[model samples]
Target: MTDDPAATFARARAAAGVLFFNDNDQIMLVDPSYKDYRDVPGGYLERGETPRQAAEREVAEELGIHPELGRLLVADWAPSEAEGDKVLFLFDGGTLTKDHLDGIRLDPGELVGFQFHDIAHVHDLTISRLARRLVHAHAAHLDGSTRYLEHGEWI
Candidate 1:
């Protein structure tokens, strides 16, 4: 392998998402119009935008709500065979009040619908890797600590 720094390093794609919860401790998941599985409100980061900014933008674009996101819950480095290396950031979206939930407006172009799911059943609603990430994120939220994961597992 060549020693040139530029040639030796590969650029990894990045995505940011927010984990929203309700008073009942259920996680909010969004149904993307293009995906078969449910996901949190997030998307690929735009050019030059920070992960947090991307998360905020995605929530507004997908759900049409601008709730202030809290601390980082999980930073996962998950590399996929089809998508290549990816770094995902999950942020805390503090419990949503009834008013906030009532104001949700799903963007027809991006998300078809959104629902609250119990933590125990997150695996049934989303992909395995994502389910693991969400579970870790929820644990971090409860303990007020951040987590670093590789392929959705703590390392």
Candidate 2:
């Protein structure tokens, strides 16, 4: 143990994202320029920002849209060798109207494009852990509940 109690704790990186669905119940995913796979509209939480605020800010910065986000859907504790430990939060973006969809303006510096995909194909498009998180987040949204997951699986 360390002399200072705070030094004994691990500092996990945290990120916040939103789950958006279209009228067809398809999930909206963004192709990030920095990553090989698609992801939801969100990014890491800045210092002095709440998870929800980070989510909202990321959406505006990445997509240039300001849709109201709903309740928390899923929170996952995922540890990665490359990224160290991480805590991820997913919020409900509700169903996007045509107008909301039309207003999307992708930030070319961060994202390439955005697409809507069938929920069944999520695993094919992203990493397994992220796919699991999306699946559980969608279920939580449908049932109006929240979920806690470890590495994207319920304990």
Candidate 3:
């Protein structure tokens, strides 16, 4: 265990993403400046907002587009290396067009680059395991079924 006091216990965290597809069927993703991982277009929720509202706010703040939010794909708990414990929420949104990307106003301090990849290519994003579960759940959600577990079962 580490000596950092912030690592004491898990913290409840909320995030969202728009799984928009383009005409070519690629999902939109962004590379954050603060991390080397490519993640979905949303961030941690603010103090007074619901997860859905946070998703809308994050998408607009980071990408400058209003994402059409969708079904609750994955809502589960996971551990955070820095924040200790965290609860994650991943939503479902349909595919978007290149025009949406072209019109985006990115937050320079947070996002560095962006890309759209095929659903099958989502594994290349190099994000958190929770994200991987969300991606898998997205596919499962699209297939009209999702079988992910709660916090304890997540590894």
Candidate 4:
């Protein structure tokens, strides 16, 4: 709605999260103390940090575990009334064994606890856009292909 090019240019926000699985194939989710809904382990990028770095850093900060990100799962361009313009990336954290689970020490200020949730029930516990993104990312993980989403829709 602006005549100036600067004003018209979209300043998209970016965030990165990691999707970890258990032996049962359930995905790991965290309960954030600051939010009503559950979320994957991740957060916004710091100054001069890349999405992948932010993904790894956030996991360590929030979960107290450092696991290599296996692959890019979903890179989504999400625009909506609730979230505004943004790009979100979900990375595969591969499968978490018992040792990894035992290592999850939540940062009490950021996270309350972590749980391995069935993929089918994840939708009921998170925001709609995030749920959709996770579903797409999960499928991509199974096929070893990266996925792109626009507002959580495969495109």
The models' CA-based lDDT, in order, is 0.95, 0.95, 0.69, 0.91
lDDT of 2 by residue, 1-155 (tens): 66899986889999999999998889999999999999999999999999999999999999999999999999999989999999999999999988988899999999999999999999999999999999999899889899999999976
Which of 3 and 4 is the better model by TM-score?
Answer: 4
List residue ranges in candidate 2 displaced over 4 A.
none
Query: Hey, what RMSD does candidate 4 come out at?
Result: 1.6
Q: Candidate 3, which ten residues in sequence have the lowest lDDT sum? A: 146-155
Q: What TM-score does each of the candidates earn?
A: 0.96, 0.97, 0.77, 0.93
N/CA/C clash count, model 4:
0
lDDT tens readout by residue for model 1, 108-144: 9988888899999999899999999999999999999
Q: Name the top TM-score candidate.
A: 2
Off by over 4 Å in 3: 1-11, 128-131, 146-155
Q: Distance (Å) between predicted and true CA of 116, model 4? A: 0.8
lDDT of 3 at 90: 66
Candidate 4 lDDT by residue in tens digits, 6-114: 9878988899999999988889889999999999999988888999999999999998999878888999998777778889999999998778788888999999888
